[model samples]
Target chain A: MPEERRLRIPGLKDRIPAACDFVMHAARSAGLDERAVHHCQLAVDEAVTNIIEHGYRGDGLNQSIEIICRAERDRFVIVVVDDGPPFDPLWQSDPDPLASMEDREPGGWGIYFIKKVMDEVVYTDEAGRNSLMMVKHVQDAPRLENLRDHVALKVSVSNPVDDIWLFAPHGRLDARLCPGLDRLMTDKLEAGKCLLVLDLGDVEYVSSMGLKTMVSLWQRARECQGNLVLAAVQTRVHEVLQIIGLDLVFQIFPTPNEAAAALDNPPA
Target chain B: MLDINVSAREQVTLIEVRGRVDSANADQLGEALTREIESGHTQIVLDLAGVEYMSSAGLREIVSALKRAKRGPEAGDVRIAQPSYRVREVLEMAGLDTVLQIFPTQMEAVGSY
Candidate 1:
């Protein structure tokens, strides 16, 4: 993993590529694959471009851009700062990339792309400067090796009833937390503990990768003739599930206790 | 950046792309396919199995190609062949899977044209 660094440079369009170059070096040094590198590059480029083009009105020659980056074992975090006007990039309506080309005007598409490519993006303006912080979790297996060390995922196991083990993972189940969740849950299933319920009540957000982890774990549990189910899904979380069409795949329960009880009854 | 390798199979020309196709590199791909269309090679298949990750920007280029390909008198068409799992996810997520002609292999794609 590369050490975190901060760079202050002029916010110019030509300087956007240089910012991407700096991001690529950090991503590559952190052992991110080319795919991840491209994600990091495009995201940073867009952020910088927006700050220069929209925020500073293309004449950011005097204004300075502050870039802070961190390439950890499992995730890359970048924060771009511009001493420009206070404008919320995320406030724009997201363009549906699926919209027909004739109907697709270039309105807020870059912001949409940045939001889609990165795992998390937050914008804040303070002290007369605009700041955009973005995070992207590495997807390769190599990053998985040290994932637990980098991101702390609290997985608490409780045998609430006989023949059933309930695993409650606390915090965001985004890309940084999936590897740890996968290792912990899969280890238990492989150890012959078949019936398990993953309590996502504490999980803030579940990325597409997180859903993939849950699906794979479900597949593994089913392969061994055991059961794995989701418990106490939050409304936002369930909405995400519906978006990816995973709601049709999993058996959802209202509470962990209900889920445990349904271990015998099973949800219809 | 996108790595594109264009190959010929009878009247159909296959463009094998091997890299990430995002906003940064999608225009290059559009230009590559546009050149193919300009050269009267309308029957085209884009092999996306080598593409590891594709964002909506990549989907935009494919849509651009599809729109341009439809305009010609030959009524040439563009098809997708052997898209990777991630690529297919993006295609389906963006509702382009049904719009684009997808085949399991380049042979199938070439045969369709």
Candidate 2:
């Protein structure tokens, strides 16, 4: 495989959607799963938005944001380069997310979300330009199981149950955490268990890239004679879902457990 | 670049956020707002209408100004006017619209201040 694709767009908000589409297409052509493709898309958005807003100061006429997507054996690397003033996005240390919204400041959450979503984040400010590199591992291959401690937000599979959980993750489902969700959903769907429940209790936002992943996963689940269900969706996520009209396609629930139970005995 | 224009009605600070607002320039806008606040200006308006986009860094500047106005000794008030649609979307997404008062017209914002 050539293993890489590159694009350069003028620093403008209008170009952001095209830039994201280019990355999504590249990832799909590289044989990456839909979720992984979505992760790359959001990562590209966050990076390019930074470049357009901060790098060129929204001067679409002046500067440009460059994106490069490279596929590795196990991971995909997306590099965003800009020729704006020297600024390193990786060095930004986020203040405590747990702080109260009032006491807490408003900015810096974009980079924080980017760091949290990607597995590995690297930044460089060489030659008075900024380069942010994000990496996400591919989850198509069957892998060994490691007995890791279960974290609250970490996605994992329980026993071989028939229910499908379609977690319509809102917010920035960026490069950091998409792989985990992809792995969990794919593993369960591949096992032919159809009972699904998506916990969206915490998802308040989702990028277009994230939406694409959810659609692909829904298709995969349908192919297996199973269906995916969403639960406890916040208004913000629900709005986007409704905008795309996926809300009508997927079975929605009020809670994760409810969706899981309904999957066990779907209404005729 | 920091560009400040004052009138008898209000002090309008137009901080052109050129680059990403990460930690680097996060304080640049905040400092500009604070300087205006300290100079005995109670009624202030920020014209982010020129700002093509904003991130958490740029958002922090707005929040900082809001807090300063709220805590000022003389009941200082700050209003944001003419934020771009993208900026407005982000603010609504983050629920900052509920926290910060937004105005569509600079005249409305200035009048409020």
Candidate 3:
């Protein structure tokens, strides 16, 4: 049997949370990591919100929105259907991100974010019903046991310096494993070991939750007059950070030892 | 779910938002920001540390507040402090980071006023 779930809700802004919860449950059950789950949630949220605010307008109390979620082996697909007018959110011109405050408008971001987060977004109008199909590729987390072994043995056993801590995490840094890493880093911070280096040499992929964990730890480190740096980030993971300009915020080095050394010697 | 807390200090009025900000409650947020602006409290520091999620609706309110705060005789600005990771990403994606100044701590955001 194909893995699928369906929900029908009133085309109202108040029903957005229900729609999001229904999709999220399916996404999580499909083994999508936290980042993909968030993407799914946001995509659905924007879609439903758009339908209520624009498609149904204030008359949504009488209208209904139907949502369908399908979990394929390689991808998760969401389809939103409504009886509203024929309007394609994808057809709207993207708002200029570089526009000055005077020229900027607040209307286009909902659709823009939907496009950016989803791998594919397709809008279709049949008869009088409108349907939007969004797809997100499911990135499987790497073998957790192997990664656990690598992190357990390396971070806990080796210490080139007492003050600067080094953590070499292997495999994908997705939602499944970020909580573990977050706890470990949080413990270090609580113990007053603030200066830290994350060796991303073996990390193959990063999820939104993983990025959040890193940023949270970095901020915490800075709050205590310490810093967190990245080292040997793989090209794929590095590209993710670079896209969002996080590379400028966190000092990245070629190797963990170098990252540790930099942390040891503060620049005036 | 949304919670808005407003506290007035000597330099800036701090609005701390927690929970999700979507179309459902964005108007409430806009109203809260507008209430402060109408009271001539344009020097605002938005503390987003507790915010779990925010969409374009929330961004709209913040941008509107920033625009409103900059106008009039006592022109001031709205600053952000300690945005959650997701909130920060949304701001960057919307290109609001360039227009609205962001600080690492609430103290710094207030001090900038």
Q: Which stretches of candidate 3 lie over 4 Å from their true place?
A: A140-268
Error of 3 at A186 (Å): 50
User: Which tens-of-lDDT digit does each residue in A1-268 have in candidate 3?
Assistant: 6698999999889888889889989999988887667768888999999888888887899899999999987778899999988876643656777789888876668877776676556564545688787776575332222211222111221245767777666556777567656866787799998998888876788899989999999999999999999999989999999999999999999998898888888798
Worst 10 residues of 1 chain A by lDDT: A141-150
Cα RMSDs, all models: 14.2, 15.3, 19.3
- The candidate, 1 or 2, that scores higher on lDDT is 1
Report the lDDT tens digits of candidate 1 across residue range A9-80: 796765665777788898788777776677678678778767776787878889889899888767777888
Candidate 2 lDDT tens digits, A1-268: 7478889888877677678788879878767765456546656777877777777886756777888988877777788888988776643555454454466665556665455445556564444667776766566312312101111122322322433444433334544456556665777678786556666776666677667767777788788887777778888889989998999888878877777777777779
Consecutive 10-residue window with the lowest summed lDDT within model 1 chain B: B89-98
Candidate 1 residue spans exceeding 4 A from truth: A1-3, A8-21, A24-42, A49-65, A71-76, A83-85, A97-108, A117-119, A136-268, B1-8, B17-25, B38-40, B48-57, B82-93
TM-score of each: 0.51, 0.42, 0.66
How does residue B111 of candidate 3 score in lDDT? 92
Give lDDT: candidate 3, residue A32: 86
Which residue pairs overlap in candidate 1's backbone? Answer: none
Which tens-of-lDDT digit does each residue in B47-82 have in candidate 1? 998987665567767777888888888978899999
